[model samples]
Target chain A: MNERQKSKLVVETCLLAGKIMIENGSEMVRVTDTIDRISHNAGATEARAYVTLTGIIMSATPDMGSQVTAIDKRTFDLEKVSTVNDYSRQFAAKKISLGEFYRCLKRMDKDVKPFPFWLQMIGAFMVSATLEIVFRSNYTDFWAAGFVGMIGWCIYCLTDHYTDIRFLNEFIAAICIGFMSILLIRAGIAKSADDLIIGGLMPLVPGVPITNAVRDTLSGNLVSGPSRGIEAIMSACALGFGVAMAIKILG
Target chain B: MVNVIIFSVCVYFATIGFGLLINLPRKALNMAGIVSLIGWLVFHTVNVHMGGYLSADILGTFTVGILSIFASRYKKMPVIIFNIPALVPLVPGGQAYQVMKCLAIGNYALAKSNLIQVIFIAGGIASGFLFAEFLNQLYLRFKTYIITKKATR
Candidate 1:
């Protein structure tokens, strides 16, 4: 490729790396660092990248112009982040050509595969049941928590698949958890609704966003820091509201 | 002692389950569990003897942060692959639930107190991670300085 085309490809590669990282729940500092590293390794002098929670803007020298990409969805998939980091390291060490690295990244992005649905449900079940025992120091509600948590997680995934409204899935899932835990308690399956509710909600909590917001803020990311913080708070409020609504209506 | 062991076991599995939920690399799953187990052990010990959940949380997350850094190096993966899942046990999910419960029952005073506690725990986790990162940076700089000095000599 000619000089202009090569530089444009480099910039495109950097933007793709940033988009994958951000969408997969990487911190702002890490996302920008990965973009800069990819461009720098690809022979882009004076390369700079500005990233926020919602978008990425990257530029090399003036002649190469700049590339901007908007991030639409965010989820938790550390495997992709780790894979991208590994590829960047390989590129830096001269183990892979820039074209090969770009092709691998593009292929990986297209072939994104999460764990099977049933397996993720089972994971939710395990987390809820065990976390209740860990936090409350009791196994009285173990099976109840597991069943309720699995159902809540299922509802969450289904709702997210059907609707594009932000936070609605979490709200509906929390309500399901609260109502199911209450019903289980009334049916004598669980002794305490508190344990079951907390456990069930574990799968839907905003743990990743909360952690990422704090990390971004501490790393001096002025834009993404507060934006992610607000995002976390909004989701938390939605979850809390759903639970509260369930309790006020039933309990 | 037996209670602590039980809590540790539960934490290990819980961390592993969360790791799976977030689709953490399979290679790092076991190490993430170990990291969270260590953090929970420290938190339990300090909370039982010292009677302060705030300090316990901060110390626990600090330990997790430091261990995750090492785990990432050993596994050749990003630190977050270990760090985020390992911090699962320390997150104040239970406390946040309490706040919602209190609000639902119309107990404003109790709800206010629980909300504050939740905020304090979150802040503690943030500070703990910050301290660990600061220490890591200092160590890296010191190592580079020693290497450069040796090369000059």
Candidate 2:
């Protein structure tokens, strides 16, 4: 309510946002969530404020994910970040219009740079595998099986490169790739179904789930975190099955 | 063993360099890499016994999952970038190539079995984590929902 309390809330919120933004690949969504939580402390409107913030980010840089890690993002000191978060939450709670939020996002993007790691890696890897299959001397169903993986690889790279690249991306890509691989292989394109399925899953390869699995266990989030662990396993199995059935069908 | 350490160090440096590029303090970046490397090693060591593509998938996923957590905790580095070196080795390149070869020659059963085997290998890695996560949560919730609820009430 008071300026002093608002100030403290702002500082903490900003610092938290900076940390999460720095660590995770997705910024816009995380920042929004941070603002929503911090707005409660600042006598600000969380919903209206977040919409404003989202608009600002979208306008500033169409690719908010890439911009999150840019050097410019470092300029968001605790106070400034805290104030912005509070302001949005307050505005949102009041059902206020967020013309300003949209403007800020637009401005913010000039300072944006999308993270390219996932993109380059996925693309490079996909290209590599696709090339290997496409170039196979004999034309066979094997390449067909691997084709879905190539697409999953592309989606994985696209999503991960500029977005949060979460656990879901890995699973979805793997499953899609797996599903497609079987279909392609069964058609007797001569490509081994399993090989193509596994190859297609390259993009979804585990990066954080393993770490989180242990860390969650370490920190004691067994229920919430481990469920994610199981989901990862099941999805991976689904991916395998998706392809296997196709193979069986052709047989 | 020696190669592992050397590679780990290189990954650490490259990861740090990326952190620096994004303006993270040296201490934070170094810490992220250290945590990630430990995870990578755990995966590599545990899954090394599996032959060929299977080994690569297990190690790669394990290495990456751990590295991302470190990055997430540090709050200053991009978790994805930190996972680069950890993932490179397990891209499924060689296995994909060979399987394609076997199939092209009309080895349906071999291709089918290999497909099942690699999928199982990758799935197995996820399953290991599932065990760790599930037991950990069950214990935590059991304490909270049962013991803690009684005490609090």
Candidate 3:
């Protein structure tokens, strides 16, 4: 490719890298770092990336126009983040040519595969049951929490698949967890409704976002920090509201 | 004690479960679980002996943060992959749930206290992670300085 075309390709590659990292729930600082590293490794004289929770704006050299990519959806996929890190490290070390690196990134992005549904359900079950014992120090509600948590996570995934509304899936999942926990208590299968509900809600809480918000803020990304913090708070509020609604309606 | 062992086992498995939920790479899952187990053990011991949740949380997350940093370096992965999963057990999900329950029952007083507690715990976790990062940065700088000094000699 010509020099101009090469610069443009570099910008596009950086933008694609940033988009994947941000969309896969990488911290804002790491996103910018990865973008800058990719552009720099591609021989850009002056490359800069400004990343926030919602978008990424990157420019490489004055001749090549800057590129902007908006990030609309985010989900936890640390595996993708690690893969991008590995690819960038390889590119920086000259182990992979820029063309090959770009091609690998494109293929990886297109062929994203998360854990299967059944395995994820089992994870949810184990998280709820084991956390119940850890927090409440009781095994009476172990199976109850597991079943409720599995069903709640199932509802969450289903709602996410069917609905496009933000935070609605978490709300619906929390409501299901509440109702299930209460039902189990009524059926004399669970000893404590509080323990069961808390355990089941473990899978739904916004732990990653909250931690990322703190880490971003601490690392001096003022823009993305509070934005991610607000996202965490809003989801927490959605969960709390759903649980409250369930209790008000049934209790 | 038997209780400590049980809690430790639960935390290890629970951390792995959370790791799977977030799609952590398979090779790092066991290490993340061990990090979480150590952190929770520290938190449990501190809380039981001292009767302070905030301090226990701060110390627990500090240990988790430091260990995850090392684990990431050893595994050649991003620190976040290990940090997020290991931090799950220390997150105050139960207290947050109780805060909502209090509000639902019209118990404003209890809700207010629980809200403050949640904020404090969140802050503690944040500071703990920050301190760990700070120390890591310090260590890196020190290592670089020693290398340069050796070169000059």
Candidate 4:
């Protein structure tokens, strides 16, 4: 490839890498740092990266000219985030050439399987059950939380797969959790419906978002920080709305 | 006490499940669990003695931040892998849930209080991390300065 072609490829590669990291919920500092490192090492004259929760804007200047790319896709899959992170580290260390980095990124985009749905469901179940212990609930509530959590996660997986409505999956999942926990209480299987519902809700909480928002704000990325804070609150509202609807109906 | 043990063990598995939910890297899973267990234990112990949830959050998050730095170096993984999951149980989910539940039920006063509590706890957690990071930076800079000075001598 000529210098122009090589620079264009590097710019595109940096943008692609940044998109993957941001979409996978990486923090702004890490995203910008990785993009900068990759582009500079790949022989760009200069590179700059700006990231937000919803999109990414990155530019690179090469001998021929300057190139800018913006991607507007947002999703959360931390496994992919970790993979890109490790890959960037390797590339920065000069262990991977430009062609190799491109191939690695393509392979990452195509490969890297998510955990099977059933395992995620089992994880949901264990989280809910163990949350009862964390909340200091009795064995009855413990068993109730386990069942409620498992069923709730299944509902979440199903809704998330079948629907594209924003926040609808969390809404429906919370409704299922609340409804099942109440039913367990009515059936005398759980002593405290509130405890059971809370435990079941553990898996659906927006803990990661909240933490990331705080970290972002602390790091001086003011715009991204508050936006992420609002995102976390919105998620909480969706879960709460679902639970509330279930309560209003079940009562 | 036995209760403390129960809390630690239960939170350990709960955190592991949480790590799995977010699909943390396989190598970081067990370490994340240990980090969670330690964070929650410190939070619990401090909250019990200090009678202040905010203080507990600060101490717990500070410990998690420090440990995450070391873990990142030792395990050669991103610190977020350990930090985010370890900080999960301390995110004040219950308060956030209460804020929504109260609002839905038309309990305005209760909802307002829960909102304030959530803000306070979140702020405390952020400050904890900031303080830890600041200290870490200071220590690194000082070490570098001393190393160069000694070499010159």
Per-candidate clashes come to: 0, 45, 0, 0
The regions of model 4 sitting more than 4 angstroms off are: A62-73, B150-153
Local accuracy of candidate 1 as per-residue lDDT tens digits, A1-251 = 98888888898889888898899988888887888788878888788888888888887887666789999999889899989999999999999988988898889856657888998999899889999888887677888899999999999999999999999999999999999999998998899888898889887777778888888999998788888899899999889999999999897
lDDT string for model 3 (A103-177, tens) is: 988998566678888999999998999998999988778898988988999999999999999999999999999
All candidates: DockQ: 0.82, 0.08, 0.84, 0.67
Please give the CA lDDT of all the candidate structures. Answer: 0.88, 0.44, 0.89, 0.80
Ranking by DockQ: 3, 1, 4, 2
Candidates 1 and 2, the one with greater DockQ: 1
By TM-score, the candidates rank as: 3, 1, 4, 2
lDDT of 1: 0.88
Model 2 Cα shift for residue A52 (angstroms): 25
Q: After superposition, how far is residue B140 of candidate 1 from its true place, in Å?
A: 0.9
Give residue B82's error in model 3 in angstroms.
0.7
lDDT per residue (tens digit) for residues B45-66 in model 1: 8988998999999999999889
Across all models, the iRMS values in order are: 1.0, 10.5, 0.8, 1.6
lDDT tens digits, residue span A1-251, model 2: 55544444444444444343423322233454565554443444422322221122211212222112222222211223323443455555754334344344335435344335444343434433432332232224334433554477566545545765334455455555655655665555545654455445543444334333433444444453464356445544444443444444444
Local error of candidate 1 at residue B59 (angstroms) = 0.4
**How good is the docking of model 3, as DockQ?**
0.84
- The best-first sequence of candidates by lDDT reads 3, 1, 4, 2
Task: List model 3 lDDT by residue over B39-87, tens digit each.
Answer: 9999999989988999999999999999999999999998898889888
Which ten residues in a row are the worst by lDDT in model 2 chain B?
A: B17-26
Consecutive 10-residue window with the lowest summed lDDT within model 3 chain A: A56-65
